[model samples]
Target: MILQPDSKVLIQGITADIASTHGSRMKAYGTNIMAGVNPGSGGQIYHDIPSFDLVEQVVAEIGAIDTTLIFVPAYQALDAALEAIAAGIRQIVIISPGMPPLDMVHLLRKAEATETIIVGPNSPGIIIPGKLLLGTHPSEFYTPGSVGIVSRSSTLTYEIALELTKSGIGQSIGVSIGGDTIAGSSFLQWLQMLDEDENTSAIVLVGEPGGNSEEAAARYIAEAIDKPVIAYIAGRKAPAGRHWGHTGTLAMVVGRGEDVGTAQSKLAAFKSAKVPLAERPAQIPELVKKALK
Candidate 1:
């Protein structure tokens, strides 16, 4: 299941420098953050929340954790994520700004076998307007409505959401699969799930010049989805030989750089699928309204 309001939540690096700020905000936003886990800081309460050394401790005492937000640094992300999965946490969101690509490879392989869902190695996180907050997403920019949002760029995610809200179009859910070239969830995964979501009437997919994720999503949207879908591809003028957000891109890029399709190609893919394309953020709401028609 996607992160829910009632999910027993834990912060793996809750005592870290950045954790307390976002932790407090997430709690204030009404996420059921049940516990905090900082290996050496266990038994010491932080942010007025109980702290534990291990995920199992949270499970044994506070009950099973449904989701975890990891704030550990890039080096520790793999260990922290592995521990959460080992403790039966199904949904893991890595809010770390960077993680070794090889580390992500190992973590993703483990996640696949365990059926764990990883959100980002450098993601802003997920938000359901007027309901739940999971990462660093700006909640004030979002309003509750029927459009479901999925994006690969952090800046564009907020920009697109604010455009919808400004146009009086509220969102059912907004997700940043992160800026990484390789992420846990894909456009196809979120597109499929949002298509099934009862509250979502349409979807806004934000893409950039990267791997063929957009192309794959276009195929799925054309063949499988009955819901109205809108596409917005970023980096229209980016040099075709390069891609943005290189944290994870550099890893897979070596073996499959050619697979990183250009923004022009992505725009073409969505157009070919006959999906409405938004050339700019401001253009999305009108396109969204058209799709929902």
Candidate 2:
């Protein structure tokens, strides 16, 4: 399958077990939720959809071709993640949290080995307004527009869209790239798509403290791109050696005299290259408008 932006999706792991915890939000967002997988829960119903015991059964019965949101437990998350990939599922969105770093590394390697594209082991998944919504985001937060959004923070992505909406601007595509230290895709990959998209007038990137992915993206922007980019890095004051929330929010220094891992300094580099920085989240709308003008 081509995995067009509007393809059908199946959501696994959405049973009474996890539905009470996470599945409810996904259903509320208008996902097909074709079937939930919870061992003996097959034949059970959730949000009016039949539950299945395994992904193979769901795929065979429902023919959901494009995407999946893996909400299984951390211990079994890797197996579930690999299963979806092995089944030739194109876009798998992982919403489960607390995945071990080694597991994520292994999953990424497997994904590379299989040529599969995974979204998050700790992500909000992807949402293309009015077409397909396979993630945990509230539908009301987004509207259709020309700017494509890709961020490491789901709540912050919502906040940015909310700010954009208040100014009568909306998004073309909004993707939460997950805050994990090991993620399937990068902001640059998303940016390349957004840059080539005729519907996308500009791009907004949201970054956090952990890795230099944002910094590398900034350098890419400095080198190329006729499109304007507005960036904001969160968790500036995050203490060293204490990566509390997001996996990649802590900076790593290779050796002495190396400047790294601070959101403020990382974001400051953008200003040097004329990339506008939002002093605060509230300023994002204005910064985007200014960038376009």
RMSD of each: 1.8, 2.6
Q: Quick one: RMSD of model 1? A: 1.8
Query: Under the 3 Å rule for N, CA and C atoms, how many clashes does model 1 have?
Result: 0
lDDT of 2 by residue, 119-222 (tens): 87678877666655667766688888887788988898888888898888888888887877777788778888788888889888888876678778888888
Q: How far off is residue 100 in model 2, in Å?
A: 0.9
Relative to the unseen true structure, what is the C-alpha lDDT of residue 107 in candidate 1, on a scale of 0 to 100?
89
Best by TM-score: 1
lDDT of 2 at 9: 66
- Residue 158 in candidate 1 has what lDDT? 92
Q: Show the lowest summed lDDT stretch of 10 residues, model 1.
A: 243-252
- State in Å the error of residue 48, model 1: 1.6
lDDT of 1 by residue, 213-236 (tens): 888899999999999999998888
